[model samples]
Each structure stands twice: as structure tokens, then as C-alpha cells.
Target chain A: MSQGPVRKILLFVDGSEECITAAQYAVVLARTLGAELAALYVVNVSVLNELFKARIFIKMEQMDYEHDLEQDGRRYLNYISELGRAKGVSIETHIEKGVVNEVVVEKARILGADLLAMGELEPIKSRSDAFHDESELILRKAHCSVLVVKDADYIERLYQAME
Target chain B: MRISGLLSEKTISRLTRTDKQGVIEELLDLAMNSGQVHDREEALRAILAREALMSTGLEKGIAVPHAKTRAVSEITMALGVSEGGVDFHSADGKPSYIFFFLLAPENAAGPNVQVLAQIARLTHDRSFCEDLRKAESPAGMLAVINDAE
Candidate 1:
């Protein structure tokens, strides 16, 4: 079998259950392909800006909300990093503050990543309809190949087998 | 209500170094001299370890290199301005001119995160960043931060 040309992989994670499932697959792929892995968690600044403009949160309160979101991003990135470590796949973690799709694509390009991996999209609520949805936008505009994992159970099973 | 309250004149200065490690070291030295950080070596190690995990260089010529460690008693912040941009490996592929080095207690994650978010929000404005770059002295930098708030 000819070896794949993938040398670097970038994974976008948002701490969702589905994202965790996708992260498991990313780890396995990185280990199998001997590729360097990087995980990114964007703080979704555009959504926060909308909430601020809508006066849903006062200035001080908005700062607090942004802080909570960043903490969440850090936790999720750290979790993925740990998972990658356990499987002998070193994963670098990044916490970017910006629009989700834009940041993901920009980071991928900057890292010279060969492939971008993300979880399948969850149902969007009404409140999120106002902004550009990240999943579809990332798929359509990514500069590199993209892998969207839809089968959470299958990935989870593979992850468990590695333990 | 302004984040500038966290920064003192002594904690702000111009960075002469053109590399990320040297810049971080200089900022950490400033934090130590200000008596905000108890152990300089430990704080430097912690910050570098975090940097190794990910470059904190954001877009728009700004880099917020931060770490939550027990080396500091509180959330300590130091600002460095580099006239000749340093290679921070920012996502935009541009050199970073403004550097914010932050050290916080492990238990103060909430406030630490808030300070980072506040810095990000403030620097997102191109005008504000321009003013920050023009400020030549530590007091000038503080004034820019205060005026922006």
C-alpha cells in the first residue's frame, strides 16, 4: 500500500460530546499516520459581539461571559491534548479568540496543515441562526482537506480499544 | 472597571529583544522586579511550558502569553512594546509588536481568564492598537489603556 502524504493534521474542538468523539478519531488517525496533531478552540468572538450589541450583557457582565467561554475552550483543548498524549500522539493546543470558522481556517493555513478534522454539526438553535454557522462554512472554504466524523459510537469504541 | 488598574507604570516598558523567548524573559523580569511575582524562575518555566503547548500570538500584532501558576500571589500582568516586531509565530504570519505577559495563581483562574479576555477585547480595536504602539513611555502606555477603557 502506498503511504499517505498527510504529515500534519489540525483538529477543531468545541468541548461538545460529538467533538470529543471526533477528537478520538483524530488521535487514532494521527497515531496511525505518524502525523503531528494540533487542536484549536476558538472563543467565538463574533457571537459575543452580537450579545454585547443586543445589550444582553452589560460591559462588565460581557467580560465575565467571555472569560467563562475562554476557560471552557482551555478545558476542552487540554482534554484533547491529554488524550493525544496517552496514545503517543503529541498534540499542540491553541486557544484563539475570533469567529469560529475564520479562525479554524486561518490557523490551518498558518500551520501548513494537510488535513482539518471536526465533529459532525449538531442542530442549531434559533438564537444561532443570526450568525454564519461554522460547520458548513468551514467545509466549503477550508484550504485543506476536511474530515467530518459522524459516527460518534464507532470512534468511541476505537478509542476504548486503544486503552 | 478598567483593566488598566492591573498594570502599573513599572510593569510596562519597551522590549529590546527581537525573539519571543527574550521578550518573555524581559517581561517576566519586570514582573519580578515589581514584586508581583514571588519566584521568577518558576514563573518563567511555567510561562514557557504554556508557550510550548501553543503560541499565544493572536491576530493584529498582539501576543498575550499567559499561564496560571502558583509562582504569583495574584493575577500579575506586564506589557512590552517592540518597535521592531518579534517573530511570535502568530496565526496571521505577521510579527507581533505588542506583548502582554500574564502570571496568575492557580486558584485565580476566573480572574486570570477575565483579564485575558479584557485584553483581547481592548486590542481588537485597530485604533487602540495604533495608539498603544505610538505610546513611547510606560506612563504613555498606561494612559492609552486607561483612555481606551
Candidate 2:
């Protein structure tokens, strides 16, 4: 029973439901294929830029906000690692401070990951829609195989059965 | 950004759904009816698609289900409190009682993430969650949020 050629899997999580779902998929894929799993959380410094430029949030508040975001990143990374552990999968976690798309792609390349798993791209209204710009960039530029995991419909069906 | 500014009296409700997908659909429908979301079907699809990727169930009985999509013209929010918690496949393996549904314009990552972070911060406070849970009505929920802010 050959498990394909996947050796290393990189998962990008951001505490979103989609990210969490992707993490689950990554864990299963890793366990089934006997691949090493690594999760990355980018702090999204771009948000800080806007927070500072707008001066909407005071400096102290901004500091507190940034700290909270970092804490969130760490928490999510830990959660994913714990998920991996519970599933008997060895998972490596990376918490970095940078732009989301670039950081993910760079880390995936550096780790020589064979697959990059993430959530589905948000729907665009027209040709100019830019909702999932980071995802778009990663999909186009990543060296490894990109998997956009979406399972809402399946989940809905499961819940409907319960109803 | 003030958390209260993102939420309104109309957006807060007592959730009746006991399942994750039902709760999400109910909240998104509320946002759509409020005219914040431009397209209900598209928004629902995008949010659900995002959910399939991950469970937004955070610890402390809170879940933040969010999506950035072309279905919304702006960042919109709907907060639903369920007395009977719904199973959300949380990392903590606990049911989620408080649900924050957020829909944002495809390009507005800044506000979208900011609101999600704000909701997460609020949920971290045990007292705040308690206050929210104890809220008698939508107005009560808004009051708790305003006081916390």
C-alpha cells in the first residue's frame, strides 16, 4: 500500500474555522501517509501598520492589541500541535512575525514541505475581487502542492443528520 | 476600533440552533436580513467553506466563525448567544455557547482580523463571558460589550 510521495506537510493556521479544519485534514493526511507535519502561524505585521497609521487605537492599546494577537498565534499553534500529538502525529510548530502569504510560502520552501494545506479561498464577487489575496499568491507561487481544504458542506450534512 | 461600533442591537440575538452549521446559518441569515450582507447564498457558501477548513470554536464557550468574501460590501457582524451550548469541535473539546459571526469584504483583512481579535479578547475574560451569558436581551449583550470596552 503505497502512501504516495508526500514526505513533509505544511499547514498554515490563523485561529479561523477554516484554518482549524485544514489542520485536521493535514493531521489525517500526515498520519495516513506517514508524513511529517509542520504548522505555521504568521503574526500579520500588516495589521500593525494599519493600526499605527490610523492612530485609531492609542499606543498603549495598540501594544496590548499586538500582544494579544501574538498570544492568539501561539495559542493556535499550540492547539494544532496538541491535535497532532493526540493523533499520534509528530508536529513541528513555527510562530513568525511577518506578512501571512509570504511567510507561509517561504517557510514551506525552507522546510521542503511536499504539501501545503490551508483553508478554501473566500469567494470573489467579480474579476477584481481581492478578498483572498494571500491565498491567491500562495496558490500561484508555492513550490509545493497546495491543498485548499473546505468541508462546510460535509459538516452541514453531519449536523443535518443529528437534526 | 471600539468593539461596540462593530456590533449593533440588531445584530445580537438569542440563538436557537443546537448544531454548529445551524448556528452559523442562523447568524449569517440575521446579518443578511440586516442589509449588511449583500448576498446571503454567497456569504453562507463562503463562510461554510471557511468552516470546512477549520473549527472556529475557541475555548471558554466561544466560537468566532468568520469569512472574507465578495458577498459582503463591508465588515458585518452578528452575535448569537446559545443557552444550550452547541458542539463546535473546539480544541478544548467543549461546546460553544457564544457565537460571533463576521463577514467582511474580500479585501478588508485589516478590519476583519481586528474584529475577530477583539471578540477573542472579550471571550478571554471569564467575567465578561458570564456577563454575556447572563444578558437578558440583545440590549443586555450590547451593554456588556460596551462596558467591557
Candidate 3:
């Protein structure tokens, strides 16, 4: 049974290798569906805080890292836009600062996206890892239809065919 | 894009200027040497205008003074390290040590934003900042950036 037409798609990008494959697939899907695409990169503040708490990261001098992370997010979002451009699809880019999963879900809702796309996640090493896995959390929290793009080889072929 | 890729020893300098305006002009001259900027005066005016609106002096001894103008053909950047620290009217009221002078073509908004962000992220590292501060020469500064990248 079809849920409905997918007019808008929101893609979550993290600059991971897997996200590149996901981006290719997202571009292809958006092109095929004639859907408006928006790519978002969230600066995971919670992860930064976790590193700070664990002493893995030195104390932030004055929350300047947040601005840095925002810029980092823009860089990642720009990459997604490039991917979309290569496929002859136009993608709007957005950056947000927050817990990654929450931000992704909220953006999907706010965009009224019919579909949300993201990279394939790594295998959870343990139950705790699964519990904290951002992709898993996003899958649970997203109100729109979620698409996890795997099969990198096939997606690469699909993206290249668009050229 | 990586800031390291856009930077060269010729575009990196140990700034002798003690004031913000002098340091910015010094850096802009270095950027012009890269041959990416065609109109030096236009770029200077754009940067100063941006400064007039609000200081780009960020806290923690970092300042990125940037502008978009037709003067630059692409996203060009110059790195300056000031040992004496120049007052930029930063948010913390602290003098800024590292100066990233960026100029981009008016149309290249995407790469310009990405480059600015890359600079911010790299400078945010305390060790990176410390290493940059200690760089003795233009070549030394390039090496620090190379190692960081």
C-alpha cells in the first residue's frame, strides 16, 4: 500500500564515507521523483559535551567550538549540495546545532518531508551502542518515512547513470 | 575545501603590524601576492566595510576578517600570526593573535562559507592555535597548517 506521493525529501549528512553513498542515492531519488530536496548537517553538541565530560577533549575555551562546529556543519552541507548539483538536482542546505538525532527528526517534521534519507549506519557493537546510536534514534523518532541508503555499488551506478 | 589547499608560504606571514587596520592591510597584501585577487583596493574596502558593521574578532585569540567582492576571482585566504596581539574589539575584549584574511568572488558564496568554516574549526583547536602562535616563519606556519590538515 502506498502511503502517498513523496514531494519533498530531507537528507541528513554527516560527511561520513557512508554519507557520500547516501548522498548519491538521495540525489538520484530526488531527481527521479522530481522532489524538492533539502540536506541538513547537525553539529552534535551532545557528543561534544560527552567528550568534554570524559576529558577526551580539552575544556572549551568559551564555547567557541560551537561556532567551529557550525562551520564544520556548513562544510558538510555544502558537500551534499555539490552532490545534488552533479546529479542535476538542486538541494537546499541547512545546518543546526543540537543532538543529531533530535535535530534530524525535527527538521524532517518542520520541512513536512514525505521522506527522510540518511547513510547506512555501522553495526552496533553492544546493546548500549544500539541505545545511543544516532541513526537508530533517528529511525525511531522520525515522523516521516525514513530511507536508509545502502548498496553503495548500486547507488554509485545509479548516480553515474544520471550524468 | 581545506584551507591548507588554498594557502601557501607566500600567503602566510608573521605579521609585524600592531594595529588591526595595519595587520589587515598586511595580510591583504599577502593574499594579493597569491594572484587570486585582481583589485586590491576593492578587496580592502570590502573588508573594512565588513569590519565597520561589526568586528570579526572572535574570542580565544582568533579573528577571521573576510569579505565577498568582485576584486577576488576565487576564494583566496591569507594567514597572519601576530605575536604582540592586535585589538580587534573581539567579543571577549581580548587581543587577537591569529588573523585569517579571506576574500572571495561575490558569486562564490558556497565555497567562501565552507572555507571560512574550515578556518574556524581549525583555529578552534587549542593545540593548533598554540602551534600556530609559535610558528617562526611563513614556511613554519604552512607546515603547522599542513600537519593540522
Candidate 4:
């Protein structure tokens, strides 16, 4: 069954407080548009490698942190699924390991998403900060329409209003 | 997810049980107080069935008895410390001093796997396990977990 302009929504989450809010918004949007929803979590392995090169973490510590981050990504993705489940929206979940923005863009492209939903971007303190921010990079790189979710209270109410 | 949020003073205990079955019961009782469990008997059966397949004992004084069943509303966890040590048929053939009991909804396979991984990582740090075992009260034990996260 075809909905409106949106058919599939790919939600990119990174275990952030805002991602939970974004997930809520995505669930509500999916239900309203009758669109399929998939939540993606990237392990951001490159950041760990950067830390290792910076001498902030030794080999063992880097491996351990990498393991923890992978687990965290799975946990966050599962959380989004449960949120969708509660609203009677079946959500698919995916976890990948790579640079966060690159992985998200690749997954969205592969999934052929009609909309790419993400948490509110962090305040860009400078052009360099914006250049380095993964969320901003995702917004710039995605081929589909992007939805940067905000207003946690409003999203919560919308989610709660759903059956 | 913060491990601390899933646990509290109400969901932790200094186990009075000295045996494996006794300790499981004690932990389940603590889980009941969390108000997340839907069916106590089903949860217990699921845990025991998991034990029937293999022991959750991961060595180094830690035993993580867990299950995924419809009996839990979400992923619920209860922790216990056995000062005298309980024999859990650990991989290392050693007594288990700390127990991390986890119950998840049957459909929550992904989260269950992640929680198990997180527990494995926590158990890898002997000092963290030791701190939890040395904790005098549930609050103290909770503090150790909060600090580790």
C-alpha cells in the first residue's frame, strides 16, 4: 500500500538523549504516513581508532571500548524497536561499524529511504565544528529528505497520542 | 542504557542463599519488587530452562543467569551478592560471588544480547566485580555500578 510522498524512513541514532526523542518522532511519522521504519545505529569505530592513535587508549583498552560501543549501539537500536512496537509499528533495526556519517548515509542509500530522520544536531560553535559533526555530515550527504527532529515534549505527546 | 536505571536499592540484595537454586529464587524475589515482571512462574521457568541448557556462570566469581520470556514487560534486572559464594557450575569450576539476573521480553532478542555483552565486559574487570562484592548495602552496590558506567 502506498502512502503519501514518504514510503520508508531510516532513523539514525547514536545513543544520544536526542536520538530517543528522534525515535519517538520517527515512530509517529511512520504511523501517520503508513511508512516502513528502520532504525540504524553505527558503532563509530573510527573515533576509537582516532583515540588509539592519540595515545588516549592502549590496544587492549581500545578493543574493550570498541566492544562496549558495539553493544551500546545494539542496545540503542533495540530500544527504538521497542518504542515502535508499543505504538504497533513494526520497526527494523540495523547496526554497522564505521565512520558514523558514512555508515548512516550508506545504509539509507541501500534501504532506499524516502526520508532520513535524525536527532537534533548539536549547536555548531564554529565552521570547523560543523565540518566535524557527523549529524551535519549525514544531513549534507543523504539523498532523501532529511528530518532533524526537535521539541522533545511535542514528540513525546505525539507518540503518546498514538494507539 | 544506564545499568543503574534498570537497578535500584529495591532490586539488589545481599543474598542469604548459599546454593544455586536458592540464589536464583532470592534474585527473582528481588526482581518481583521491580514491578516489571508480568508472570513470576513463567520467568522462573524460563530461567531454569536456560540453566538446563548451560550454566550462565562466566567465571571469576560472576554468574549471569538470564532469560528472554513474555513474563517481563521489558528488560528487568536484579542483582545479588553471595559473600559465602555459591556454586554455579562456573566455567572455571569456581564459586560465584555475584549474580546478575536478567529477564527480557521474548521479542527483545537484540537487547538481551547487548545486555549480556555489557555484563561480560563488566565481569571482565575483576576490580569492578570485587567492588560490587565488597559493597555493604544495596545502595553501595548500586554506586559501584553507577560509577563504572
TM-scores vs. true structure, each candidate: 0.51, 0.50, 0.58, 0.59
lDDT of 3 by residue, B2-96 (tens): 57778899999889999888998999999988988998899999999878766788879988887778897888999999988999888689999
Model 3 RMSD in Å is: 9.3
Report every candidate's CA lDDT. Answer: 0.80, 0.77, 0.80, 0.82
What's model 2's TM-score?
0.50
Best by lDDT: 4
| Candidate that would win on TM-score | 4
Model 3 clash number: 0
Q: Which stretches of candidate 1 lie over 4 Å from their true place?
A: A1-3, A124-131, B1-149
Backbone clash numbers for all candidates listed: 0, 9, 0, 0
Query: Pairing residues by index, what is the TM-score of model 1?
Result: 0.51
Model 3 per-residue lDDT tens digits across residues A19-94: 8888898888888878888898887677556534432233431154556667767878888888888778899888
Model 3, position A126, has a per-residue lDDT of 32
Location of the lowest summed lDDT over 10 successive residues in candidate 1 chain A: A124-133
Window of ten residues with lowest summed lDDT in model 2 chain A: A124-133
Model 4: pairs clashing at backbone N, Cα or C within 3 Å: none
Candidate 2 per-residue lDDT over residues B1-149, each given as its tens digit: 45677778888899998988899988987787568787888999988876776677767788878776799888888899999899988758999998888888865554565666566556778999999999999999999988877
- Tens-digit lDDT track for model 1 on A1-163? 1147888889998767878888999999888887888999988776667544432233654565578778888888988988888888788899999888999999999998999999987664322221345777888889999999888888888987885
lDDT of 3 at A110: 88
Q: Model 2 clash tally? A: 9
lDDT of 1 by residue, B18-58 (tens): 88889999999877766878888899999888777667777
Give residue B81's lDDT in candidate 2 (0 to 100). 96
Reference contacts preserved by each model: 0.00, 0.03, 0.00, 0.00
